[model samples]
Target chain A: MRTAEALRMAVEALRVNRLRSMLTMLGVIIGVLSVVILVAIGTGAKNAVEKEIAGLGSNIILVVPGQVGLGAAPTQSRLDLSDVAYVRRVVGDPSKVTVAVNSGEPVRVGRVEVFATLTGTDENMPHVFDRPLRRGRYLTGTDVDTRRRVVILGSEVAAKLFGDVDPIGRQVTIAGVRFRVIGVYETVGSTFGVARDQEVHLPVTTAQRLIGLPRINGIAVGASGPDEIEPLRQRVVAALAARYPDETFSAVTQTQLLGTIGTVLGMLTGVLAAIAGISLLVGGVGVSNIMLVSVRERTKEIGLRKALGARGRDILGQFLIEAVLLTTIGGVIGILTGVGGALLIQAVSPVPASITWWSIVLAFGVSAAVGVFFGVAPARRAARLDPVVALRTD
Target chain B: MSHDERAGRRDDERAEASAEPGAAGAPAFEAIGLTRSYRLDGGVQVDALRGADLRIGQGEFAAIVGPSGSGKSTLMHLLGCLDRPTSGTLLVNGVDVATLDDARLADLRNRTIGFVFQSFHLLPRTSALDNVALPLVYRGAPRAVRRERARAALEAVGLGHRLTHRPSQMSGGEQQRVAIARALVGDPRVLLADEPTGNLDSRNGEEVMGLLERLNEGGVAVVLVTHDADVAARARRQIRVRDGRIERDT
Candidate 1:
C-alpha cells in the first residue's frame, strides 16, 4: 500500500475517535512540558551563576581565613595589614595581579544608619570588582599611603543615607569616627539573594585605623588574564601559608567556585529530568494501551483491508504511523508549553529560567522514540491478525 | 411441488447457465481436491472441506448453496484467498493458490478478485464514494484516479447522485449496491458475494440480485454464496454442498 493511503486511513481512524486520541495525547503533553520547563529552570540558574561569576572577573581569587564548607562564611581575620605587602612583593609578577582587602560594619550617615559591607581597598578596588564610580573619584594610591579618611558609598547605601541629597564630601561616622564620602560606586543589582550595591568602599589604611585592627577579613585579587588567575592564586596561597603558619587562610578562584556550582546544577537538572521522564514513560504506556484497544476494535476493518489486498506490513505501518503521529503532536505542544512556562516564570519571579535548542530537539526525539517503542506490540498484533477470523468477528 | 414444474425449472436453469453473458473464457478459479480442517477448542479436529472439486469460469454467474456447517463458506474463504487451504491444488487464474505467499495472495486479491460480504461491510461514517474507492487505494493508484474510477463505478451501479450518502443513511438495498460498486471499482477478474442479500427485505433482496446479474452481464465473473433456494436459483449455475463435500454441480 502507498504510504499516503495508509496515513490517510490512520488519520481517518484517529478522527473517528478524536476525544479518545486527545485524552491519550494529554499524557505526552504533560511529560514534554515538565521536561522543557524543568530543564529550562536548571539552565537558567547555570547561566545566571556564570554571568555573575563573569561579572566579578572570572580570573579573580579570594584569600580568606577559613576552610570552605557548604554555605559557610568566614568569621574573623588573623592575617594583618602588614601581610598585604608580603602578598604583593612575594607573590609572582606583581604587574599581573591586583589585590585588595575588605571588611564590613554598620555606619551612621546623618540620622540614617545603613547596614553595609565596608570594603577597604585602594585605587584597584573598582577594577577588581568592576564597580566603576558613578560620581566623584575613586581613591588614589596616595590616599591609601596617606591613610586619608575618605569613603565611596555603594549606590543603594548612598540612596538610603542621603536620599536625593549629594553624599560626596559629606562625613559619615564609623565607630564614632567620621570619614568623608568622596564618591558613590555604580549600581550592581541584587542576584542570588545578595545585594552588591549596598557596600561602602574606603581606603584600606583608614578602615584599619577606624576599626582599630591591623588585621583584615579577606583579600580579593584579580589577574590580568585567565592564564594568570590560577598561577596568581597559587602565589597568594604560598605567601599566606608562609605568614599565617598553620594554613589559617584559604584561597578560592572564581573557576573553582564555578566548578562547584556547575556540579550542583548538573545534578539538579538530572533529577528534574528523571522526574519528568517518569511522566513521559507513563504517557507512552497510555499510548500503547489505547493502540491495543484500537486494534482490537478495528479487527473487522483490518480483515476487510487485508481481503482488499493490504499486506501485513501495510497494517503494521498504518498503526505505527498513527501512534507516532499522536506522540509527535503531543511533543510539539509540550515544547511550546514548557518554553512558555519557563519564560513566564522568569517574567513574574526572580527565578532564572532558560530554554535551549537542544532541549526542544531532545524532547521531540524522545516523543517519537516513545511512539515507536510503545507502538510495536499493537502494530505486531494488527499485522499478525488472520483475515478469516478477523472478518468473522462481529 | 409438481414434477413437471421441477423439470421445467431445471431445464430453464440449464439454459441460463449456458447462456450467461461473456461466458466464453477459461475458469477464473478451479479447485481440485481442495480441503480445509479446523482444530477445535478441545483439540477435536474437524474437516471443513473434504477434497472438494469445482470450477468457476469468467463472467459467469455461479452460486454455491449449502446448509449451515456444510463448508460452502469455507470454500468461499479459500476461493477468496482469505484463508490458505489445509491441503489442495487450488488454481486462481492458472496460478496455484497454495504456492502463493501471503503477500502474493494479497496482491492477487487486490488485482484479480473483489468481495462483497453479507453485512455490506461498507466502512461506517464515510461517503459512499470513499467506500467504493478503498480497493483502488490499496492498489496504490493516484488520489485523482481513485476518485474518478470510484465515481464511475458508483454511476455504473446507479448510485451516481448518492455519492455522499453514508452507509447508515442509505437503505439496505442501496448499501448492498454500494458494496457491489466497491467490488467492481477494482475491475477484478472475478467478483465474490457471500450472502449478499441476507439482511434485506424480499423486494430489496431481488433488487440486489438484479444488480449482481447486471454486473455479470457487463463481463465481470460473479460468484454468489447463499442458503436460500430462491437466491441460488438466480445464478445460471448452482453448486450444492453437504457434509464438507460437493453433493451436486449443475
Candidate 2:
C-alpha cells in the first residue's frame, strides 16, 4: 500500500480511540518533562555559582594567620604589618598588592549609631577587590600616609545613614573618632542571600589606631591577572614563611575554593539528572506494552489486510509509524509542560531554573529513539503473521 | 441420490470430455488426478479431495454444491489460490500451481482472484468506500485513481449512495454488496465466493446472488460454493461433492 494512505489510516485509527491514545502518550510526556526540568535546574544553579565566583576578583587571594586545628570552629587569625610589607616587597610590584585590615566597630552618622564592619586598606584596595566607587573618591595614598580619618560608606550604609541625601563630605564617628566620608560605594547585589555592599571603609593606620590593635586580623591581596594568581600565591607563601618563622599562615586563592564548589555542584546535578532519567525508561516500557496490546487487538484486522494483499512490510510500516507518531506528539507536549513547569517554579520559588535549547533538542531526540526501540518487537510480530491462519481466525 | 449413481455419472462425463479434442482458448482451471489430504491430531489422514478432475472455462458461471463437510470450501480455497492441492497437477490460467513460489502465489491471488466471504469480512471501522479501495491500494494504484475505481465499483453494485457508511451502520445485504464492490474493484480474472448469501434473509440473499450472476454475465469467471440446491441451480455448470471426491459434474 502507499505510505500516504497507510499513514492516513493509522492517524484515523488513533483518532477514533482518543482516550486510549492520550493515556498511551502520557508516559512519553512525563519522561520528557522530567528530563527538561531537571537539566534546566542544573544549568541554572551552575550559572548562578559562576556569576558569584566572578563577583569576587578572579585574581584575588586571602591570607589568614595561623592554621586552625582540624574540625575546630572558625576563629579570627592575627597578622602583623610586617607580614603585609614582606608580601609587597617579595612581589616586586607595589601597584599589584593591596593589604586590607578589617575589624568590627561601632560607628555613628549624626545621632544614628550602628555596628559596622570597618575595613582599613590602601588606595589599591578598590582595584584589587573589583570594588567600584559610585560617588566620591576612594582612600588615596596621601590619606593613608597622613593617617587621615576618612571613610567610604557602603551602598546600604549610605542609604540607611543619609536617606535620600548624599553621604560624601558627611562625617561618621567610629570607635570615638569622627571621619569624613570620601565616597558612597555602588550596590553589589546579594550572593547566596548575603548582601555584599553593607560595610564602611577607612585608612589602615587610622582603624588600627582607633581600635588600639597592635596586629591586623588578616590581609587581602590581588595578583596582576588570573594566570598570575597561583604563581603570586606561591611567592606570598614563601615570603610569609620567611617573615613569620615561628607561626604558620595559610594562603587561599579564590580559584581553589571556586573549583571545589563547582565540583561538588556538578556531582550533585549529575546524580539528580540520573534519577530523573529513570522516568524515561518507564515511559519506553509503557510504549512497548501498549504496542503489544495494540497488536493483539488488531490481529483480525491484520489478518484481513493480509488476505486483501497487504505485504508484510506494509503491516510493519503502518504499526511502526503509529508508534512513532504517538511518542513524537507526546514529546512536544512534554517539552512545553517541562519548560512551563520550570518557569513556574522560578516564579514561585527562590531556586533558579533555566531551560536551554540543547535540553529541548535532547529530550525530543531521546523520545523518538525510545518509540522506535520499543516499537520493533510488536511490528515484527505483526509482519510475521501467517495470512492463511489469520484469515481462518474469527 | 445414491452415491454409486452419482459416482458413475461423474466417471462417464470425465471419459467423454477426455475423449474429445481440446477446444481452442479453453478456460484456465483444469485439474488432473487432483488430491488433497489433512493430518488429524492422532496422525490419521483424511482426504478432502481425491482424484477430482474438472475443467472450468473463462467467463463461466459455475457452482460447486454439497452438504456440510463435503470439502466444497476447501476446493474453493484451492481454486482461488488460497491453498495448494497435494499430489495433484492443478493449472490456473495456464500456470501450474505447484511451480509457483509463495510470493508468486500471493501475487496470483491478488491479480487473478477476488473473494467474497459469507461474513462479508469488511474492515469494521472503515467506510464502504475505503474498504472497496483496499484491493486497489495493494495493487499500488495511485490514491485518486483508486478512489475513482472504488466509487465506480460501488455504483456497479448499486451501493453508490452508501459509500461512506461503515459496516456496522449498514444492513447485512448492504455489507455483502460492499464486499462484492471490494471484490470487483481490483478487476480480478476470477470472483470466488464461499457461501456469499449464507448469512442474509432470502430477499437479501436473492439480491446478492443476482448481483454475482450479473458480474459473471459481464465476462468475469464466477465460482460459487453453496449448500442450497436452488442457489446451485442458477449456475450454467454445477459440480456436487460427496465425501472428499467429486460425485457428479454437468
Listed models, DockQ each: 0.58, 0.33
Q: Candidate 2, residues B1-250: lDDT per residue as tens digits?
A: 4435544654574355335344236565888878779888999998988778888988999999998888888788788776678878887876777987755666567666788988888998889999999877765667677789899999999999998999999999999999999998877778999899999999999999999999998989999999988899999999998787899998
lDDT score at residue A311, model 2, on the 0-100 scale: 70
Give all TM-scores, in the order shown. Answer: 0.86, 0.76
* Top of the candidates by TM-score: 1
- Clash pairs of candidate 2? B27-B57, B27-B58
- Top candidate, metric lDDT: 1
RMSD to the hidden true structure, all candidates: 8.9, 9.8
Name the regions of candidate 2 deviating beyond 4 angstroms: A57-84, A99-123, A133-185, A190-273, B1-57, B69-71, B74-106, B239-250
lDDT of each: 0.85, 0.81
